[model samples]
Target: MDKKKFPVLIKYCFLKGKNTVKAKTWLDAEFPDTARGKSTIKHSYTKLRCGEMNTEGGEHSGRPKEVVTDENIKKIHKMIATECVHHIIDEYLGMRKLCAKWVPHKLTFDQQ
Candidate 1:
């Protein structure tokens, strides 16, 4: 690559001091200014309704004194980002509906 292209390539690579690069940072680095400007998000609609998610990474350790571990926070982050809870709820609800429709209700156990 030419000297002029080195910086552009590096910028596209998302080199944030080291291998530790946030997904947002990587996206911003890869996308152009115009593209980034156009990528607007509506929190009311885009935000997934999940109350179990916590941003603080200091709640993972079992100890009552030690701050939360990084891995625990990462697990939550992955869960929220992938919307795993939503999928799980969807599956459970569908199964429940199917069960309600197919299964018959009985007031007396004599039929069993």
Candidate 2:
């Protein structure tokens, strides 16, 4: 049921002269829960017919596989530190901003 094995088995069925539907059926019977779809079998069968025998996938272009790098962690930590300091300073001054307007940190009940 390995992902790579699906294509290999599909290729085997192709070499045995089985059509796409038959190949899919055989795979489904062998790997009931993990069989590749008809479209996938057909695609692999097409590739086999075209003489591309390598079953493994080639390198593909897409978004990077990793996003949480050390540099990104450092950047986020620095941003949070600066924002925290700014908030502390504002709190100490008993002042806060609301909708771009300077407002007192503590408001009267009527103001609330």
Candidate 3:
């Protein structure tokens, strides 16, 4: 089960007056492979009881966040317009339109 489901289960068990032991047991039965520990259940229960269960996760800061804005979209559009797709493909992928043919010469042991 997902970590998100744990909070919902904890809330349910807490609402049903189930202790940590029973909650852990239920979790074990529900998801035998991923049975949540007592501490995890207790912490979630405490959060639910104390009305601090933030489903979206509490905010924390470290790395700068990146988001696409209208300015970025306009800049991308301008770049695409200035540099057409054919030139970009030819520059990177070496694809070009040409009219030509290969003429094979007679093979000889000396040529090899």
Candidate 4:
């Protein structure tokens, strides 16, 4: 109820009363809401901080460009080029046949 008590309340809530003088001074200067009243502050802070509201021009917001090094491009090319020889042969032969030592198959078909 008393004006002096307001500072004490803020000091108790924000800084644990270690520096009540500084806490009261900061609170008065900033006019910050009580911690209990921070739901509105939180929404505003998040919108402004994340540039969702577009109030600050969002100098730090956007999708970053994908980073592709030479090795990464080479790896991607190799991945696209990779193929299962058995799958290719089966597609063309119309049968499941082993054409090479590396082509996998059931143990019964290991002969061919």
Judging by lDDT against the true structure, name the best candidate: 2
Number of colliding residue pairs in each model? 3, 0, 0, 0
Model 4 segments more than 4 A misplaced: 1-66, 83-112
Question: lDDT per prediction?
Answer: 0.40, 0.85, 0.74, 0.47
Residue-level lDDT tens digits of model 4 in 1-112: 3343443344343434334345445555656454223343344444444644333223566655665778879988776565555546666544564463343344455555
TM-score for predicted model 1 compared with the true structure: 0.18
Q: What lDDT score goes with residue 28 in model 1? A: 53
RMSD of each: 17.9, 7.4, 11.8, 13.7
By how many angstroms RMSD does model 1 differ from the true structure? 17.9
Poorest 10 consecutive residues by lDDT, candidate 3: 98-107
Error of 3 at 106 (Å): 89
* Candidate 2: tens digits of C-alpha lDDT, residues 1-112: 6797787898899999999988888888999999999888888877888999998888999878897899989999988876785676686777787898777888999989
User: 1-112 in candidate 1: lDDT tens per residue?
Assistant: 2333433333333333322234235535655452222122112112222332222223465666645789888988888866765555545443222444532233248645
Residue 107, model 2: Cα distance from true site in angstroms: 45
Is 1 or 4 the stronger prediction by TM-score?
4
In model 1, the clashing pairs are 58-68, 59-68, 60-68
2 against 4, candidate with superior lDDT: 2
Query: How much is 63 displaced in model 4, in angstroms?
Result: 9.0
